[model samples]
Target: MTLLRPQIDPQIFSALTPRDDFRAIARWVEPRSSVLDLGCGDGSLLALLGNELEVRGFGIEIDEKGVLACVQKGVNVIQQDLERGLRLFEDQSFDYAILSQTLQTIHRTTAILSETVRVARECIISFPNFGYWRHRLAVMQGYMPVSESLPYQWHNTPNVRVLTIHDFDAHAHAAGIQIIDRVILHKGRVIDWGQNWRGSLAVYRVKRYR
Candidate 1:
């Protein structure tokens, strides 16, 4: 399968300043807790959590360049294809498993979510919200939306499934995963209202039902 590298913001590559979405996820993590970051591009978020929260952090990345970047930053990372699944990790091995901005690219979203919730006590997930007004307008206009959060044209996009926070909430409920926290963002600003149609991005903290 041909892997498409989504266009990442240059700010995501920065070491000093963490991205707002990363920060939002970070807030859910407890200090000194064990964390597994799936698709941890360049290990920026893991590094941030490691430094700020003093967590035991491991990462999984498929791209060799991203793996090398993680190693250079002293992050323990395993280069593996997530689509093949995460059976290697034992259930409840980590305090948290994170799929930040990588869920849309995954073909087996349900399977991955099941495994993630099973392997960790909790999971933190972030993604671009397809229900944003811009995306809705683009669809109505017969064009795929391209914006800062989702910066790709339809033909070259890595996102196989585009979903909104509302969609994800429904999926989580049906899957028996409980959402513990949610943060919505529009143009980098945190918003509380109209998340389904106005928010461009969102982060969710969830755990499997006991």
Candidate 2:
């Protein structure tokens, strides 16, 4: 899948990303907490979370274009290669660290997740769910699904790994990271998850024991 939808035109703001997602995310973030955003992309979520949550926010992004976008948003951005792992920050340096949408692209999800737990009291991670029915059908039919969330073509897709909701849960458990909260996003709306498998996206708040 193409990480950046070149033909879709760059959007300054997307009402497509619902406030419900932010509201869900806001619940886990206390006001005035130091927040670090990994693979922060264009800082849309960081800027929104920072402004609404009243928290100091830092963004780490590897893409040059994304770094520029973060700068434009006035988000505190550090342009660095994340695949190298997080060794520069001190332990417990922030209240929360966020890894959103970019987890699938990382070569080392375990390392990055561990780093987030080590650097902050809490962590939030969100990604496209590869096990959604549409994805299942597509794979069964021998074609990669191009849903709104997973909009990349398989040949040039940026996602190195595709994980399901259960897969993420298992990995988190193995890492000893507890799930503090979970939310599923679908068509930009937060849905009641008694039917959450129908949703296209999942967000999780995670933390370590100590």
Candidate 3:
């Protein structure tokens, strides 16, 4: 698929341009496919996809402000918590399901993953890598790392868990989810070598093992 840079509205997004994770996620989605975005913040990714690929997209967000932002952007969105699972969507209702940069904060990881795959042919997920060198060094020093990807103090953070590239790969294997494609990123650039130790973020495209 040809990836086009998304034209972002400054009013809808804090950043004037699409983030690297968004671009990476967009690359995997085919044009005009149906998409369900879980934990979609401000509907930025949906809007981007709409503009670039003309995808039929719907967003699920819990925050009132985020729901309002999606409306303002003319994107279809619903206000709902992801922990409850995707009961509203039927089997394979969408071509793709996207959970970008929000997996760590969820309490029911396995349930959500199952629901995501059940409701779509494939799912794309992105999250901060807990095994990056900086995070490891901080843990070694007896502190949680604070960086652009993870910018919260331990007490105030919403993250319920942390995992690495290997951690996720193992989890996917155990859960019978097939990881079809993966990309490791640091500072918006793809890392081709030493991904577990060097990359700060990870993205995966997956589907049911069967």
Candidate 4:
């Protein structure tokens, strides 16, 4: 299998740029692992992982422009709607399956997540935190919050179901999965306390329980 080899100079790899959440996700991945990226917009994260960790990456994207961009980046990508599920892929086909900033937008959350877990040994997911203090404050003020992570008006947003870290934890438990690692991010910084209340984004590395 072709895998990306980590650069000899760690500094060079550190200097390689990525979105904050993407960087967090990349760090959780082991070097030279196979990855399946769902809703990989423009193949940015996949390309970054391939270059930084020597991960063999495959991406699934629905948008034509995004698919074109992935091709230009030399990233292997298949065009497919995530809501339809991952029936095309077989069981345990990859080391990690990732869904970043796209969970809320998918209507079939449970189904897609199940497929992700089935297709890979581990699954990594990242999404906006609806329980953030700002969102609460906005609700208190009788309006939806507008922030960097959630940059859309209520009616115009693509996100159908925004959830919190606590919500996700409960969902995972109900789905018979275990969260191996969790990270909460607020304005690009890692926050320890009151993650459900203060965190703007939540990330998790998970696996199905035996």
Q: Which of 3 and 4 is ahead in lDDT?
A: 3
Q: For residues 1-98, write the lDDT of model 2, one tens digit per residue.
A: 01221222234444325333556677788988899888888877777776667788888888889877776666778878888877888988999888
How many pairs of residues in model 4 come into backbone collision? 1
Tens-digit lDDT track of model 1 for 103-122:
99999888888888999999
TM-score of 1: 0.90
* Top candidate (TM-score): 3
lDDT of each: 0.86, 0.78, 0.87, 0.85
Could you give the candidate ranking by TM-score, starting with the highest? 3, 1, 4, 2
Question: Mind sharing the TM-score for model 3?
Answer: 0.91
* Candidate 3 residue-wise lDDT, 1-210, digit = tens: 111233335456444378779989999999999999999888889988988899999888888888877777767887888888888878999999999998998998888888888889999999999999999999999999998888899999988899999999989966668999999999999999999999999999999778
lDDT of 3 at 141: 97
lDDT (0-100) at residue 189 of candidate 3? 94
Q: Which stretches of candidate 4 lie over 4 Å from their true place?
A: 1-17
Please report how far candidate 1 places residue 148 from its true position, in Å: 1.0
All-Cα superposition RMSD per candidate: 5.1, 5.7, 5.2, 4.6
State the displacement of the C-alpha of residue 43, model 4, in Å, after optimal TM-score superposition. 0.8
